[model samples]
Target: MSKGLTRRSMIAGSAASVLAAPALAQELPDTVQIRESLSSTTRRNTASFRAIQWRAHFPNLRNGAILVDIDSRALHLWQEDGGYHVYPSSVPQSAEMTRKGRTRVVRKVVGPTWRPTPNMRRRNPEWPAVVEPGPNNPLGTHALYLSWTYYRIHGTHDTRKIGRRSSSGCIGLYNEHIAEVFGMTKIGTQVLLI
Candidate 1:
C-alpha cells in the first residue's frame, strides 16, 4: 500500500471528520429568537443574585438586616457592622403563600419544635400536629420567628429544597447556613421578604 494519499486513509479520515462534525457544530446559539430567549433566562436567573446594597432597602442596619429575595431563592444579610453575606434559600411555593414588606425577628429558637398551623392542618389533614425537635423536624436545627404569625426564617433537612420554591409560607435555608445566620442575627434583626 502507498504511504500517502491511499484510498483507505482517505475513507478513514472522511469517516472521522463526519463523526466529529456534530460536536464541532455545537457552537453558541446565534439566531435572534434563541439569543433573546437565552438572554432573558440569564437575566431572570441572575438579576436578583446581584449583590444589593443595604441602603436600597433599609434605612439603617441597627440590629442587622435580612433581605429574602424570593424571586432569586436567596437570602442576603447585612450585619450592623456592614458585613454582608448571601445564602441560597427556599421560598414559598406560590404567590398567595408569600408575604412581602417588613418584619422583625421576634424570636430565635435552636432545636425548634415543629407544629402544623391550623391552616396547615386543614390543608394537610394527615400531617402530624406536632413534631418534636429532631431529624424529622421541618424547622431543621434553628428557627428565626418573624413578627408575622406562622412565618419563620428557618432551616430544612432537605438540602434539595434550597434554591427552590418549596415552602408553604416561609423561607428555608440549609441547616448549616441557618446555624451561621442564627449566630449572627439578633431578636430585633430587621427582616424583609421581597
Candidate 2:
C-alpha cells in the first residue's frame, strides 16, 4: 500500500466510521439541558418489585437506557442501578411510522407546544397552526425529544390512549408517566425503538 490518501478512500473511511459510531454519538448535542430528575431516590430502590415479564424482556439491558417496545405498547427506562421503570406507551398505528431502530434523547422539555406539521394540516384543515401548552395540548406536560426525525416520546392529553396505537410517528405516554420519564432521562440517553 502507498502512503498517499485518495478521495474515494477517504470518503469510504469516513462513512465507515459514521456507520460504526456509538448510538449516543450519532447526533449533535442539543441546546437544552436536563437539570432535574423525577423521584430518582425513590424509583431506584424499587428493583425488587419488577415483574418477571419486565426482567425477561431485557435480560442484559444497559443502565440509563430507554427502550420503547412498539409491539408491546410499553416504554421502559432502565435505571442507573439494576432496576427498571415501565410505562404504557401509545405507538403509531401506521405501518410506515412504526420504525425499529436506535436513537438518543436530544432534548427534554416541560409544557411542550404542538406545531401541526404541514402534512397534518393538509389532512385536517381545521387543525390549528399551533397549540400552546395546556391541558388540551396533545403533547401533555412533558416530552423527551429523540434524535430521530421529528419523533418524540411525549405525554398525551388522552390517558385512555395509552397501550394503544394511535399516533402519527411519536410515541405517546400518559401525562404522569411522561413526566417521570422526562425526569429519568438525560441528553444522550440511548433510546431503542423496537
Candidate 3:
C-alpha cells in the first residue's frame, strides 16, 4: 500500500474508534431508536425536543403568546396553537422592588441599549447615563421591553446569573434563549409575571 494511503487509513481508524467508544459506554437499548437516529444530529433534535417539551409543559397558553412564571423560574413560548417551548430564566431579586404584575410585550430589540434609570443611577452614581448595547452592556444581545413599565424580559450580560435572584428588577435570560423567545414573541403579546 502507498504511504499516503496507510496514513489516511490509520487516521480514519483512530477517528472511528474515538467515535465508537462513547456509544459503547452508553449501551443504549433498542427502544431508544429515536436517540440512536439522532446520535449524529444532536443539535437539531435537541432543539426540537425542547420545543415540544415546552409546549407540553405549558399547555394552557395560546399561540404567539407566552407565560413567564417567575416563581417557577421558567419562560414558556406559545408558537402556533399548542406549539411552543420553555427555557429556564433569572428574575429580579424579590427583596428589591418585589413587583408582581403582568404586561403586554412592547418590543423586542436585539443588542438593546442599556440606559441607567433614575434608580439605577441612584444606586450606582458612577454608572454611565447611557450605555450602548454590546457585550459589556448589562442587557445582553436581546431585550423584550414590556408596556406600561420600565421592566424588560431581556438577555443578561452575566449569563451565570440565570436561575438566580440577580437582576435589579428586570427579568433576565440566557442570551441565546432570549433570542429564541424573541423570535417567537411579538408586540402586544401578554406577559404574565407571577
lDDT of 2 by residue, 105-184 (tens): 88889999998777778989998998999988988999888888678999988866666678988899878778888877
Ranking by lDDT: 1, 2, 3
Estimate the TM-score for candidate 2.
0.67
Tens-place lDDT digits, model 1, residues 1-194: 66898854664565455445553242212111111222343324433465667889999999999999888787889898876667778899999999999999999999999998898999999999899999999999999999999999999998777777899999998898899999999999999988
- Estimate, for each residue in 27-124, the C-alpha lDDT of model 3 and write its tens digit: 22211111222223332322322222333343345436666666656566666554445666777776565466657788879889999789879989
For this target, which candidate reaches the highest lDDT against the unseen true structure? 1
RMSD values for the candidates in order, in angstroms, are: 14.3, 18.2, 11.3
Which regions of candidate 2 are displaced past 4 Å?
Answer: 1-63
- Candidate 1: C-alpha lDDT: 0.81
lDDT of 3 at 179: 86
Residue 82, candidate 1: C-alpha displacement in angstroms: 0.2
Clashes of 1: 0
For each predicted model, how many residue pairs clash, with residues at least 3 apart or on different chains?
Answer: 0, 0, 1
